[model samples]
Target: MSQTLPDFDQITDTLRALGAESEAAENHGLLCAMLCTMEGVTADAWLDIALSGTGRDALAPEPPEALVTLFDETRRQFDSDEFDFHLLLPHDEAILAVRIEALGHWCQGFLAGLAVGGIQQPESLPGELPEIIQDMLEIARAEGYELEDDGEDEAAYAELVEYLRMGVLLFREEFRRQYAKAGEGSIH
Candidate 1:
């Protein structure tokens, strides 16, 4: 029988990579635990297996005082300002859609970087991503009202686009409600 893996938190500190800031302390632990839960494997081992030898190393466990450090750094970056652009996205879907928009821009830049860097051999990127990723990408494109794919069936893509639009609208409302739940003087 196949054995279950262990869980672990997001501790990716490899080189100049800026890892995503996990939701909360509990989420941090849970993320780590979830990582380990699959096949009870280590983070390094999982990356090695899932990501084929990109030569990227597993992130080390963060120090206990990491939160404090982040807080201090964040405070300094903003200079105690009440400005935050997280308003338009209060829910997960909204956040994800925005992130996808950002990602699309980043991806275009990366593709350009590859050409500028004069890399002779093309590296395997976005390799073996699950079908769910494709679906999510399609969904995000739809959410942004983008329907520029000219190869596929137009009607079908339009339907999918509409569905994503509905989702985006609903998620926007849900996000606003969540911000409302946050109490008075909150950015919404």
Candidate 2:
């Protein structure tokens, strides 16, 4: 069976219970970016970043089971031969504004993840990556739109999401090629 993302609200609740301050969308975005850019990114490393500001210590609680499941399922999506990876965002039924805001947060987190994954100089990257990073920066700052109708706004939102999904896949492929050329092995 095809693995699917965990429920957004459920992951949100789990993160809250774990004292994580980041939203589910942002956290998932970070995870995707790290997986793409970092070699052998482990679940523990991701947890360290995701729970960074929570002030958790050695005596702190472990990540909840639901969050762990989310991490595994998301990683599986990237490894799938079907290219089924997708962003973790609020469902379509959510208010358009809420969804839009979440998408922005996701983009912000993705950019942050790229930095965390050691991509400090995006401008020097090969192919379309530099432009893609610029586009993500703009999307991250998005607040609201001035579309004429709800239908139009919905179409626009869907297009943006699709673009982001494809962009991420491209990043993964390009980075993998770079690593291979340098004999650095593949990202996990």
Give the TM-scores of the predictions, in the order they appear.
0.22, 0.92
Give the top-scoring candidate (lDDT): 2
Winning candidate number (TM-score): 2
Clashing pairs for model 2 are none
Q: Where is model 1 poorest over a 10-residue stretch in terms of lDDT? A: 83-92
Q: Over the stretch 20-118, how does candidate 2's per-residue lDDT look in tens digits?
A: 889999999999899889878887889899988776555366767777888898888877768898899999999888888889889888998988888
RMSD of 1: 18.4
lDDT of 1 by residue, 1-188 (tens): 22211111222232114233322222222222222122222333323332233333444344224333333332232222332201111222333344344333322322222232232233321232223224434433443544444534345533543443343233224323544676432121
Model 2, runs deviating above 4 Å: 58-61, 147-149, 185-188
